[model samples]
Target: MSVDFEAARLASGTPDELAKATEAAIATARGGIERFKKATGDAAELLDIFDEANAALGNLRELAGMIAKAHPDKAVRDAADEAEQELDKVATDISLDREVYEALAAIDVSGLDAATRHWVAKTLREFRRAGVDRDDATRARVRELQEELVGIGQDFDRNIRSDTRTATLPPSALAGLPDDYVRAHPPGEDGLVRVTTEYPDVIPFLTYATDAGAREQLWRLFQLRGHPDNIEVLDRLIERRHELATLLGYPSWAQYVTENKMIGSADAAGDFIDRIAAVAADRLRADLATLLERKRADDPAATAVDPWDNSFLQDRVKAERFAFDSQAMRPYFEYGRVKAGLMDLTERLFGVSFTRRQDAPVWHPDVEAYDVSRGGELIGRIFLDMHPRADKYNHAAMFTMVNGKAGVRIPECALLCNLPQPGDDPALLQHDEVSTFFHEFGHLVHHIFAGHTRWSGMGGISTEWDFVEAPSQLLEEWTLDAPTLATFAVHYKTGEPIPAQMVEKLRAAEEFGKGIFVRQQMFYAAVSLELYRRDPQTFDVAELKRELQARYAPFPEVPGTWFHLSFGHLDGYSAIYYTYMWSLVIAKDLFTVFKREGLLDEETAARYRDAVLAPGGSAPAAELVRKFLGRDYTFDAYQAWLNS
Candidate 1:
């Protein structure tokens, strides 16, 4: 079970070595500033300076922080944590540098290419936002606020990471859960099954467990994650963020966060969600009505379906109404085969190939490395870490260590997921789990294929956070498509493809609970927005959540649950949980092109890669979308998705 942290140890050198690297990066950026002052006469020379700054401030810092957060060894994580502070200091210094700002702003960008002009514009805007153009006193305050935010955010994340909550239930309490799950999780000396809130445990029990009381117990425990400690951390963070936003001339932190996003403003994001809800209310009502009816059938005296009953009830409904459900699809989706099939499909769709490298050095034995290639030439390397472990980051995400640049060195990234571990049988993924695999893999492909920027700053997943999720969301549609699923969903035991009837049922059941789904997303987005707009001095997050939930959601607020405390997104995502829905709107639209062109159309895929993925963040996101779609992005796709 032990992992070798040798890679992290090497990448995260000793404290002195880390400080030296930070100083070196700063020195290099300083030299770049001088280069820019001298070379303002030519666009190419100015771009050279900007690229050097990106390497020093962007690439180096990004790499260091990634190791600090994800490296398995405690010693490596601590060392990397120290390096992250040094990296952040160097970055903060560059962002607030008046000399760099002046040099960049003075450049003649009129004759420069589109990408170069955009780079210059973005660089200037960042400097201004960081208060480099402000008075000396204001700039000092800005620096102080930024540093405080770094510490607060780190503490909040640490509390969530260290939170250890478990539910101990008797063998009979786990009745409806999969047999493999029972075998994998043995009872302790006290003779009870210990269930942790990791996705692998929580999701299955919520979906399949027959004991309603046990479900409620687990749900309540899960909701209290990061509580008592993170609540105070979050309150302080809100205050600091509000101060920073007002300092930057924004009315609220929400406006500050959304100003540069595709959504343009917080009000617009709120209105967008509200509009979707208006259209979806009917669907939401119907979904809940169906669940309530099923609940009554089970217990006629039951007044209402509890929050914990949704997943369990939905699974039963799907089985009876659609003739299939997540568990039924598991055999065709054994994790290893699903991954291999994903690689095969990528080869056909994108003209790229991935070959596994067993000898590669990885942080954990569970991690698998691959070389992404095109026609036998290396394009990038991806490390996949897709199993659960103690203290591992529980969510599914892609972590990029190096950005890929065409004609330069290949990029390096790792895909992290806390999926079910192999038991007596190989791990069989639920259909949704398979969808997640494709989703995270989409990000890896985007980072690798899209690494064509002069600035590593804008390479890989460096696009606007709102826009970054689009590529991955678009990929999720592929996993749902019957033809695409056919490429992977073969039974692990029988070696037979998933039955046509089952695939049809899966597709048919897609709309069963979408209304409730949309409403929940709306409530989350609204909460994030209101959090920033309210006065943190006496802001009642619990009250705001209750109001938002009652207004936007179909279900009433549950008593005694502090859901926001467990919301990890509050620290990282903040006023942008709305981005998920926002990006999905665009994602659904993007998939339409593939739908029309044929999902496996090699020529269209080639064009898409070159236009959307290859340019990376060199072009504006809107411009990239325009090129790929031959028109402006629209909400029609989302409306269609909702109506379906």
Candidate 2:
């Protein structure tokens, strides 16, 4: 049952080949639907239906990658998009079919194990959400809405991905950026640097550019992405989501999103945000005052801190006050060293080892695959695609190419990231970039360890959406630990380990803008909730952002910029953007156990693997957390970290 990704990649290169693959996937789904429809009350038979149904849709993920990432051909990309739509239709049909729902629901779970029983209950919940319990006419409308939403959502993402907004700047504007970065992006006939909205270009320019006007230009262009037009798409998406939630007997889409999450309900999530924002308000004002003072020192006549000025001023403050330069640490985080060190750390801490598979099939040349094993037994396989491509997925994420079922199949997950691509030496990662890498890798580790489940529905990182970021956030703390960085941070040229003092300074600099950062996150969470809670028909997206910034954040938005248009999370995360902050509270609490024994405590790691990661969605997230902590999870850890 192994997927031939090499063949899939090759097949996706041409339209004719992609059509064949799409047809094959559809045929498989059709057969799986037949099996699900004909399933008896036997537990084994029910498992088959679950497994087959999951496998039948695997090709859709493959096609999705091709379309989002590069295929080197526009025709093929268009064809892949078409194939993805076709496959989605088949899967949606099966998902919305009440007969299939009834068949699965009718299976008796009297003597089933916990995982199986959990899957049964989740299936019922999903069916209700899908409107399977609705009347025939209402159910039909729900299916139609589902299909329409899928199409619209795809368009929204495609618009963002296809956007090629860029601003050409003179060489003087690129002064403080790295030499190699400036050289790599040569000017065109007009002799100006080509700065695109790509992370590699925009983020560095924002951090290092000496020209405030240039930085403001980049920020404004990047924020205005998918604007004017994509706003129409966003409007329909919000309205449709609201209508769907209403039909499903929910108050709003936020309620629908949080009902099954660890937060339990939208009201609970809203209340949590209110509490956090209130606690942060005093510090928020203090931070803003400090930033405004720093800004006036730089500009003499500046009245308030521009949002674009935050990073630049912060970098200056770090250099002047803490004597820490983030770009200087990049040489210590050579790509190969980081990867090998992370692998070694995992084996040492998690009692697991990985053997690289140089011959494993991959979607791109930059990707490398590894087979993860524990006690000489194969546990899972992970593919690392750690560099950016021209049309690749913009953010870092882990996608399950294949889900593991208990004693049946091994899990296969892929990490897609936009970490630095090599130029002269190996891709040099900044300190924060190193932390981001660990964060994403933590999710892959969580999925691998958590794959011990009886049902595909209950496998790897399938826990509540709000709790999903907790595992990754916990691992990010390791990047800041001096002992942890000593294991990996070696200079690419001299091979000397990063100085202990430098690590401490990096840690100090991380806390420099904590108030500003936390307040911004609070603003995002509040904005996400409000956008969903209020009526979209009368909602003003820009005005809402202005209100949120004025209320929650230190800096106000510049005039005439639509940041939300390019705010892709509004679609992918919907009303759950608060989870990023919420998950950190849980992660900091989880890390207290690690800090007590040691960062590399194998016994604790084993316990955590069994108690938290291994359970996946087989148990309620709150219960699993309580089990691991030996007491109920609470806010003490988060409060202590904030105080520190």
Candidate 3:
């Protein structure tokens, strides 16, 4: 018998179409839940029914959530917002459904395969975590809390997305920016240049702009995103999260959120932060002294380097001390060529090929879709939405469109980012942007390679939440490799490859900021953990942020800025922003094997894909690492990398 597999379709057309699609998906899920409640026969049969119900619900939620964040039309976004709330209600009902829980709990899993068994156990744990076993009144309140959280989180994110603040400055403020950036932002009829808080604008401006006054102006405005509004919204979010955790018997939301993670508990997460901070302290002090010395070159009375000065000063240090000017490489990293290079690089490494899928549906015109194949067989699909626009998601992330199920469905995902858009002038990217592209694409390929699985729940990037970033972080190492850049990093006009000497300088220059970078990350991680660990009602969020910033970071908090209000992770990652650093520890260790072998060696890449990415969430993250490395991961590699 010949079989066909269909890729997941993105919701398109009018706001009404999006609404109908959402309703239809929810209805299908509800029907699946009904069948699940009636399932019989054996453990496998009941599990199949359960997966079927969740697969529909999961796909629905992913679709609606992506639309809410990425869709172009305000009407469609609003419609998606409503659809998310409705879907959350259905999800809460499923989580609290005692009949479905009992059905799964009664299954005889001894005869099932290990993956299915693990899924069953994990599902039961989630059910309990959702308060499914509680009394009717408690479960009802749990449902209310979960439902309210959906809207609250949406409100928090919406405020940040919609609140794109701008600073109006004269053309002279563009003195230190790349020529391409200057051309793109020519003064308007008012003869004033405008810059926004979007990454494409803010990052380059901060790193290259010579006008300290303009940089400070833009920096403060960037920090003020979602202020006043998100202050109350975030407070409400924290308060309600604590209430939900306490209702479920957790001491605090931090403890509740971290219980299932690799770190084990809130205390462990805190200790890990402190350990990393301690490791970064000496480097932080040295880096601070270096920046201050450079600052004093221009201003003799300078005592401390301001936060707005860090990037520009670092760029100067790279040029002066390391003989590398970041702008010199921008012409070689034009956005279009960078995308092509990344795709070409990954294809060669992983033994897969990508062919454009012109007929595929996408929510935006800017999105480009491709079919991922191996050995001439279609395996999965991916979409790239790689530019900024008003009201779009303002960060880089991989959003799942569909989870792969072996012999049943093919995986699909999209990379939503705010990179420079190609227009009349070529979109030149800084080296850091290139690394970010590689990092997020790491998540995409992981989703594709590990996609094929027996169950949706254990498919794609479904590993422990804390370990999810490891694969992506590991891929970033490839960006700094000279051999890898030779394959695609060519000047846009001349078509000449990036010079090996320049790549060496780029690598050397990157090391200068490692200490300060890690400490700053620690500061964010501290804020993420402490906010939930403490009593939200009693502590002032801004004051707590100031204290944490002082302890972990070298720079003092600016007087009027309230960074916690705009810290988007508080809503999504919540108590686990430390995952980035935690995952990096694992990623750095994983890189040791590749560093020893040739970076372009297909044998090593294939081994990693099979041992690490192919397992998905079927086994514990540590087990997956051991399978690849023949030993457990360690922080020794991370410490060496940090201190090197």
Candidate 4:
């Protein structure tokens, strides 16, 4: 349940020993490269040695985390940090070795089988990109830039995590709320009720309680966090990113970031967004009209939509249209049952079964570790952390700790979610929550199903950035279907099936207020693109936010609340937020194929597993899509769905 200091230490090894081991690996790799270059050793053997050097460098980075968490001595902590930075430099240098690249590039593709050839080609490209084609001085600069980038990223995330405050409301101020909510949280010694951004505290208050004042208080507190303090951090991070790009001879950070992605260039990404935005704006207007009508009917005084009113109004509109409340559907979709259903769906479709692994170390007590297997052959391991916790990353998502490689250890991943925990009604799960579960599990499948035997570099989550969301988005479509829900949505107490009518009603409501949500997401993505695409000296971030927000969802800007400042996704995603829609285009097309055949057809499922899931990043992403779909994907499918 608690973090295991002893286990962390054992896994990390001693700091000094880790540094020594890293140096030894680099030395061995250098010698191996020389032998291979002289044609005295086999290329496969040299590849193994080179991979070990990378692993050693990875171990050094892990050691830094462990030492920061466990080591009491400041000197040791500093040493570990320095060791990590140095090892990063050394690994980058090895990757830039001309002999290594030449050895890889010179590999006779015809001489090797299919699997080995794939890895060799991928590794050669990676080595070339690492500056193997450049001079030593350029390689050195690249290494320095990488180290600095890592440091800046770390600080950026840390500032957000550490710079938030919890609001306190008096017990008297908690009036007009449900008794259970009020009773669950009593006033502290200071005569004030306390709440953190943790899901358990925040979600219940927002959704169930009748106290408008309390809800508004929590909403404002959550929205305003990491704002003013984080603006400086974001600015610094952007500045550092810009400098790094300039050093790499890129005109802007967006250019540098988009190079490795599926879009190939920032200009292409911009074009893609512009096309979607134009299409989306049309649908958004219709959606806004419906929402505003409902808002006016409810309040009679309501004018334009505000950010805070968006969720509440959308929920009301959905209820009115379908006579189906998502909360009412929860009782048949309890957390435990939904989890079992997910595992069953994966096993049936992908031939992967998950068995609990009790021996593995986990980050949290609520986390459950499982060894995923197919026909008794181990595929990978996953640690599911599916409850709300303080200081944990909020929201339902998956994180890859490791990725699958054939003949080696399969990837390890963590499915982190903020779904409701065991409560009075064990089976209760909001429809949206169920969808969230499936979406995240899709990511897990993608992470583990990589039958990537050869190329260790571009496997699983290592694929092109923009294409990453397709698998997950495709899975969400399954969750909303009646037939799919019937397979798992049974009552927790009696185990009775969820009524077909209820599922029908829920499906009918799927696109209700879809425009408002679409616009909200677009606003987030648009602002992110604008942030990186423009010059910071001339751009006023606040003014930019207003312009972008008005362009999507028009509303008065709330002073003192810096939305981007509190955005954690900006740190990792930056100009890439449009990937959501881009990937959805692919996802919708893939789902259409499933619909054409049969949603759960074994032949189609097998085809998906073999062609898309299994190959991971071993094949080009576009090629994988073409193989699975029998046609090149276009944005037409996504447009059709939106219009429907």
The lDDT values for all models are 0.79, 0.80, 0.90, 0.69
**lDDT tens digits, residues 527-590, model 4?**
7677777666767777888888767653456666676777777777977887888898899999
**Candidate 4 stretches greater than 4 Å from native:** 1-40, 55-87, 96-99, 113-138, 170-192, 200-213, 423-427, 553-556
Best by lDDT: 3
Using TM-score, give the best candidate's number.
3
lDDT (Cα, tens digit) per residue for candidate 1, span 530-588: 88875677667788889998999767888877778767788788888898998898888
lDDT of 3 by residue, 383-487 (tens): 899999999999999988788888777888889999999898988999999999999999999999887888888999988999999999999998899989988
Give stretches of model 1 more than 4 Å off: 1-41
Candidate closer to the true structure by TM-score (higher is better), 2 or 3: 3
Better of 2 and 4 by lDDT: 2
TM-score of 2: 0.94
Alpha-carbon RMSD to native, per candidate: 3.1, 2.3, 1.5, 4.4
TM-score for each of the candidates:
0.95, 0.94, 0.98, 0.87
lDDT of 2: 0.80
